[model samples]
Target chain A: AQSVTQLDSQVPVFEEAPVELRCNYSSSVSVYLFWYVQYPNQGLQLLLKYLSGSTLVKGINGFEAEFNKSQTSFHLRKPSVHISDTAEYFCAVTLSISSGSARQLTFGSGTQLTVLP
Target chain B: DVKVTQSSRYLVKRTGEKVFLECVQDMDHENMFWYRQDPGLGLRLIYFSYDVKMKEKGDIPEGYSVSREKKERFSLILESASTNQTSMYLCASSRGTSGAKRNEQFFGPGTRLTVL
Candidate 1:
């Protein structure tokens, strides 16, 4: 079994400032990492994913993440943020189901990103 | 564009009432999943189906059941809805892969179920 840990429960940042949400995971085998964002009342949408190659992974909304194998971390970052970027972010790891028949995603608690004006 | 649609955006039911949450995907995906999102718990998978008539239990499947009669539709069933079951229910689907590295999951808007 695998698990994800999102360190920050809430992060408040001013508009046009930079931010980073930390995430760590524990797994024995190789894993795929993902970041998803959720608005006030909507379902989650994929932000970015780190499957293989190029440790730096770029995603939508001017966001990016770096996968660190040794540290077991996939931290999401944004050079600058906007008011519209306020949302709940999640980090997830893919768990192989039934030995390659299907895959299940195990998600972290989540971090509420608040972009202040 | 991949689109996953749920039957309802909001649902309210009484205790002991049978509740059904329906989800449909237009992209002809091979796998569908049902999950519940809580305040602290990110998303707990209840059940998932790889193909028609095939279902697998996820992490949290105690009070939940699922049905996948057709390829495009998956329904989560609660035989007796309880207040504890009140949460945001999200449905997602992805292309089933045997040896692929990753399968991006497309999620629906979600149904906010309030069990009274």
Candidate 2:
């Protein structure tokens, strides 16, 4: 079984400031990591994912995340945030190469990022 | 662009009413999923379908059911609406192919259902 923990429930940042959202996971086997962002009244959109190789993975909207194996962490980072970046972010994990129903992702509670102008 | 769409953006219903939430995808993907999002709890999978007429129960499927009569459409059914079931329902679709892309789900705008 895999479980994800997004340490912060809410984070407020000034526009154009750098920010990082922390995420950690516990899994017995190799896992895939993902970050999703949901704007107000909208569904989730993939921000990025870490499947294999290269610990640092870049995503859309100038966002990036670093997967640390020893730390069991995958933290999302953005050099500079915009007001449009205000949204709820989620961290998810799934077993690598697993098939069928086992492919379901286990998601963290979530982190609401508020970008203050 | 891959597109996933839901039938409603918002819905209100009284308790005990049978509710239906519809979802459709234009990507012709073989996998469809239904999930509910709530404050603090994030998203919980209710059900999923990998093929037409084939369904699988997810982590939180106690009060929900699903139907996938066609490749591009999937439906979530609430047999008896309850206040606890009021939530933002999201639908997603993905390819059945191997590799990471298969798990990269494209989500709909979501349907906020309120059960009174």
Give the TM-score of chain A, superposed on the true chain A, for all candidates in the order listed. Answer: 0.95, 0.97
lDDT of 2 by residue, A1-117 (tens): 789999999999999999999999999889999999999988899999999999999999999999999999999999999999999999999888657855588899999999998
List the pairs of residues colliding in candidate 2.
none
Which 10 consecutive positions of candidate 1 chain A have the poorest summed lDDT?
A94-103
TM-score of each: 0.97, 0.97
Best by lDDT: 2
* The candidate that achieves the highest TM-score relative to the unseen native structure: 2
Segments of candidate 2 deviating more than 4 angstroms: none
Clashing pairs in 1: none
Residue B92 alpha-carbon offset, candidate 2, angstroms:
0.6
lDDT of 2 by residue, B2-64 (tens): 999999999999999999999999988988999999889989999988889999889999988
User: Candidate 1, which segments miss by more than 4 Å at Cα?
Assistant: A95-102, B99-102
The 10-residue segment of model 1 chain B with minimum total lDDT is: B95-104
